[model samples]
Target: MTDTAPSESTAPQHDALLADLTTIRVGGPAHTLLRPATEQELIVTMRDVWQRGDEWLLIGGGSNMVISDEGFDGTVIHIATRGIQLVSQTDTTLSLRVQAGESWDGLVAKLVSRGWAGLEALSGIPGSVGAAPIQNIGAYGQEVASVLDGIDFLDYDNSEFVHLTTAELELGYRNSVIKEGRAGVVLAVYFTLTASPESTVQYQQLATALGVNIGDGVPVQQVRDTVLALRASKAMVLDPNEPDSASCGSFFTNPIVPEHIARALPADAPRWVVDDEPVADVVVPLGETPAPPPPPKPRLVKLSAAWLIENSGVNKGFRLPGSRAAVSTKHSLAIVNRTGADAAEIAELARYIGACVLSRYGIHLQPEPVAVGVELA
Candidate 1:
C-alpha cells in the first residue's frame, strides 16, 4: 500500500484507550491502535496482523461494542476510510457503493436530502455503514437488508476479498452470516435506493409522529426528521450533553418466541406475528390426483423487550444498588452508563435484567451489542 499523510480524523495513535473510542465510554486501553485511512491501507494492515497471528480487533464507529475493563492484549484497527460512489442511476432507481467506514446516519441524511427513499425510516441509528449488515440494523420498519444490494467483503478465513450478494448474507431479524460464524470484514457496502420523493410509513409510532396513519406516504425528509425526534426523546441519538445517550443503543434484542409461549404472557403485552411456516405444495404425477398438504406450523411472535423488562419489575432508570450502570431514564430497553461506570458494572446490570426477564417470562433476552473480554452472566 502506498503511504499517505493521515487526515486529522484518521491519524494513528499509540496506546489509545478503547474507552475514548466506544460509545459507552467504558473500555480499557488498547496495546496498540491503528487507523487506516484508505481501503488499501486497511487491507494491508489487517493482512499483516493476521500473518503475525497477533490478537486483533476491528472497530468502526464503536457504537455497538462493550469491551472489558482489563482491556485487549493486542492490536486494535479503527477503520477510517471514507468514500461514496454512485455506480449507476436510472429514472426510478440508483445504486451507490459506500466505503465501510462511512457514517450510517450521515449517509441517510445525504440520501434524504437527495430525495432518495428507502432509508428515511432508519434515520438516527448510529455506527458505520459496514457494521449495519452485521446485525442487519433496522428502525421503524426499514432495515438495511431491505436496501442492500451486496457487499465487498474481506474474508478472514482464506485472506481473500470477495463480493457477496444480499441473499448470500442470510439476513434475518438482527442477524446474518457475518454475525453467526463467517469471519470477515466488510470493505464496502452497495445499496439500491428508490428515486422517489416520498416513502410509505409502516410503523405505527412513526406514522403517529408524522401525524399520518400507517401505510400513508409522506415526504422522506419528514419521515427522517420525525424519526430523529423520536429517537432523541428516548435518548437513542448520540449527544455529548445527553447522559443517557452514553449507551449501546438498545442493549437487548426483542425476544421472538413461539405462539404458544406468547399466549402464556399476560394480556395487553405487545406481541407481533413475525413469521409462520408455509404449507408445502404437493403435486401428484399426471395421474390427476394430489395429496393433502400438511398443516402449517405455529407462528413466531416477537415480544417487546422493553415491555417485558418493565413488567418484570425493572423499570426505566432502575439501577442496582451501589452500581453506576442503570437503565435509561427515557427508554427501558437501554442500559446507560450513569457516571463513570466500569465494564463490570455494566455487565452485572445486564445479567440482573436478564435474570428478571427470564424469571418472569421464561424467555431469555439476548444482548444486541458485541461484548469483548466480558460476560453478561
Candidate 2:
C-alpha cells in the first residue's frame, strides 16, 4: 500500500471535505479528512492525526453522529477502511470477523440469508460494525453484545492495536468505553453467532409487534424483516423521505431509575421496577394517565425514552433560532436538520430540548449519537 502521510506543508482541504462527511449533511470542514482504504492505511492515518496533536474524529457510516456547524478545527479520520472475512462456521454457529467500515444492514442481511441468528435482530441499524459494540447496538430483542466475541481497537495509550473480549469491553445498554471515543479507533469486530434452530424472543414488545413468541422457532429472515418494519414505522430506520429516520435511533437511553421513583406515581400508571433491586423504570404514560400498570418484574424495567420526550412538552418540529434545525415532525425525539442547517444550529436546538426535559421532568436526556466537534446543548 502507498503512504497517505501528510507533508509538513500540505493538509487535506477542510472546506470541500466537510460537505462530504456526515449523514445529516452538516458540520464544518476538517483540517484534514483521511479516508483510509485498508487497516494499514487506517493505522497510518491515525498516527498522522495523533502526531499532529490536533483533535480528531473517526467517522464510519456517519449515521449516528451530529457535528457542530462551526466545523471541526482539527483532523477528521474517515474510516473508509473496509472488509469482512468469515473465519469459521459449524452446523450451529458461525464465527466471523467484520471490518468496521462495512454497512451494518448489509452485513446483517448477508448473514441472515446464510442462517446466522445472532445479528438478525440488529438488521436495520445504520452505522458501521466497528461502532456497533461501542454502542452495544441492539434492536427487537437482542443486543450485539450477546453474539459479540471481541474487537480490535487502536490502544492510543499503548501506541499499538489490541484485541478486547466482551467482558473487557464492558458492554451495557447502548454504551461501551470505545463508543465514548476513548479507544482511539475500532478497526474490526468478531462475533460468534448462533446457526442453531433456537432463538430467544426476550423482548415482549418485539413478540407482540411481530405476533410471535420464544420457543416458537422463527426463521432469522422473518425476524429481520419484522424488526425493519417496526423500526421504519417509528422513523427509527433511515428513511430518506422522512426526516425523522434521518436521526440517530432513539435519542435517549431509557432511564433506569430506582424502584422508589416508580412507586411514587399513581397505581394506575405503567410502572415496572426491578424485583430484587432498588432500580426500576416506570413507563410514564404519554400525554395522559395509563389505564393500568403492568405487573412488576425482576431486573431493570425498560421504559420508552420517546414517551418521556413527548410528555416533556417538546413536540415535533420544535423550532428555535430561525429554524435551521428542529425536532422531526413525525417523531418527537429526533432532532433534525432543516433548511440548510449547520452543526451549531442543531447543537443549540439539542441543548434547548435537553434543558427543557431536565428542568421539568428531572430526566437528563443523554443523546444517542456521538457528537463530533460539538458539545451537547
lDDT, candidate 1, 133-208, per-residue tens: 9999999999999999999998999878899999999999999999998987899999999999999989999988
State the C-alpha lDDT per candidate: 0.91, 0.74
* Segments of candidate 1 deviating more than 4 angstroms: 1-13, 277-289
Q: Please, what are the lDDT tens digits per residue for candidate 2 over residues 181-235?
A: 5657888999998875445666777788668775466777888888888777767
Model 2 per-residue lDDT at 246: 50
After TM-score superposition, the amount by which residue 178's alpha carbon in candidate 2 deviates from its true location, in angstroms, is 2.1
